[model samples]
Target: MRNQLAISSLMGLALLAQTPIGQAASNLVFCAEGSPAGFDIAQYTSGTDNDAAEPIYNRLTEFEAGGTAVVPALATRWEVSPDGLTYTFHLREGVKFHSNKAFTPSRNFNADDVLFTFNRMLDKAHPFRVAYPTEFPYFTSMGLDQNIKSVEKRDPLTVVFTLNKVDAAFIQNIAMNFASILSAEYAEQLLASGTVRDINMQPIGTGPFVFQRYQKDAQIRYKGNKDFWAPERVKIDQLIFSINTDASVRIQKLRKNECLVTLNPRPADLPALKADKQLQVIEQAGFNLGYITYNVRKKPLDNLQVRQALDMAVDKKAIVDAVYQGAGQLATNGMPPTQWSYDDSIKDAPYNPDKARQMLRDAGVKEGTELTLWAMPVQRPYNPNAKLMAEMLQSDWAKVGIKARIVSYEWGEYLKRSKNGEHDISLIGWTGDNGDPDNWLGTLYSCASIGGNNYSMWCDEKYDALIKAAVASSDRSQRSELYKQAQHYLKQQVPITPIAHSTVNQPLRASVQGFRVSPFGRNNFSGVSLAE
Candidate 1:
């Protein structure tokens, strides 16, 4: 029986490696961490969603592969006015949008497509937005709605943007995944057919890959865009994102040669994976932060003393030791140490359960107070094991006479519920989208981010003002000073307890080539190929 089972496994591996009708050998299967909340990146903020949209779409500008340097994508070239309020972009000519069963493009990508993409997010009464009510979380969180005066079409190939004030990170912000351009022609077709919501389900873009199909929590398939503007970059014939939430299962699939690449491998499994000759493990210091957000809107948590007490009770060192298993560093600031303007001087509250208990009692928090603790269902670079971390936190809070009930849901539901301010305290983290201080300060804690990525539901006028001043100025010294002050202020507010900055690890088959480790935690397979 054992011999027969082994033979069956060998036959399956042989079949996977064979070049079948669709050239299966040329196809790359990535063991994705979780399913995307939606295909429309503008409506979501998670990395899983960004990974799903990246291949199927292109931003006006894009971060250089494996790095944060901004470069032209759909736009061939761009210029900014000296006053920094106006910018102009020249679109790449003859770029064709993907065609599907639903709609086909009548014209190449032009200024109208750019206008349609931004207007839907900027204008509350946009025709498409009105028909399909949704929130542009990343756009609103970054305060682009307030900054962008208008996105006007100069011509078929030219577009101009007028800003209300100087924003140093404006170019980098638009390069993010949320700013991926959409097909205006497709939008019009969907609108005319009364299928506006299909825009998210059946995406059409001018990127390296065309959307084929998606089965929730199962797999998302794509075919290489033969009409891609950068034809040389699209190496693979097909791309498949095999969604797997369990790290152990993803690793097993990779070992069996069923997957070409996998993300966020468990730290404990690194040694054996490194020893395997058939696999290669890539590691890099991730630009991210894992933290516990205390919903300031919740009772008892609204008090600063209660928040401080809860923060002090948790043993961050223990969490680092167990959850990360030597793959992460203890984080003290809201942003990671790798980011510019990170204030290393700010200190985390020391672990002291006795003082926390007294502080909680003084703040009128009764003994055995019940509180809900939410854990992430998916593993992220900054958080390898949220369930273990949550369990540890529950134990620590119990020492302070607090009863923490750990709770979790599906990845999409978890994010939605947390954003709706349903959880008392939730485990959430962020990877830097752009290499700007404002990306961390403004997007996570500003008044505009209240109903979005600001899981803490914290909006401080002073902190917001500091970040505003920082982004307004282009001077490095002045921006650095203001950002440092903002970090210190965040430490004092205690809206979130920053935990760890982890080292991202990617394990792939030895045959995989040109796989770059993105600091943003994005899985981009444009230049990747499978070696025979």
Candidate 2:
């Protein structure tokens, strides 16, 4: 049945490709790496899921295309109080929300939509939350719920956010994908029809594209939002996500003209891709980190010395050479070197198997200690080939008397199990959501993120305090010092082994234009179009 479905899907794609370049010139088919978990960006944290939501939704603030600088979107402009506790946003009037067969928005994007969007995540007793229970992973991981004292609507066109404390990254935090706005009018319509859950499954937002249909693990289709406030940016008439998990398959689709753009191309394929006259490869220093998270909650790994010994055993350079193939730099800190406040003075532990073995002995760890190494199933910009990287680490650990058993599940299951502390060690990585150090240090290592993005399940009060202090201070130099201290503290704790900071490689047909590789590792097709 699966084989038949694959063939049928391929056949449909071939038909799509047959639509003459003149007739289908405005249509874009992107060979995405995987299926989105769902359309509700707030409910998930993965880039794959965010890619699905990018066109369908717009945040009050948005990171500029190809850069991390925050700019206005739904909200035309905003004001920050002198005390840094209150934020007032003036909404852009006449912004129309996308409509589906189920619900049509009677009102424009307003303060009510902002309240409904955030309140559903913040208030436990919110009507939408009560009808369809869910957790906003990114929102909670970043401590937005705790930091935000209240969200109040000043008027139909203005909204106010009062923070419990000064948040230095407040603007950048809300500009992330998880903060994509939803239409309150549409939500109310769904609630009245007793189908509130459809708000996520059938999304309605005020972005450049309108949601049309989604065939799980196959394809998703959208039409350019004719009523979009920024209609000039909606260059393409149609956008399609062709879900293809295999890197090789996506490359093949790109070569065959079945897909105009493809993501995370295998590192070995870069040279040939760049040499190809028919293709254009875009490379950028990724604001990302690939790391091996030691589940500190697990028995042997709970020991700091054991974690340090494991970190010493693996050769990050070898993995980078073999896996990334010259497309990455060795990462020595929890956050990437490109990020501000990154301490270059911090050094990684030397790769010495003998020293690692002795350290394990000193820590009272037995020779041949067994551990399960969970590898990712999908390709991310930070880690091109996680399975191969896992095997390399397994071999490196074996030399230091550690019996590493490499295991993997489907992409979604792998993340869920690892986040639930099911693995002794897991291969995971992150692309910075916003250009903030807190987005990395806070979201991944902070105490509040323990059960969510913090797969290490490790937290220390002093480390948490440092990050918290960094977030509370608006002063750059002070925040940098605090973040540096936190990095030093992380080096001593060794909860995770920093692997590499990879360069993002995006390959598309030469005919494709206006597609810029996002620093945040998301694909946005707003102003992208195809040449005849």
Root-mean-square deviation of candidate 1: 4.2
TM-score versus the correct structure, for each prediction: 0.96, 0.97
Q: Give residue 202's lDDT in candidate 2 (0 to 100).
A: 90
What digit string (tens of lDDT, one per residue) describes model 1 on residues 9-86? Answer: 445434654533123556888889999877888999999999999999998899898999999999989999999999
Instruction: Give me the overall lDDT of model 1.
Output: 0.91
Cα lDDT tens digits, model 2, 277-358, are 9899998899999999999999899999899999999888889999999999999999998899999999987888899999
Error in Å for residue 466 of model 2: 0.6
Worst 10 residues of 1 by lDDT: 14-23
- Candidate number of the best lDDT: 1
What's the CA RMSD for each of the models? 4.2, 2.0
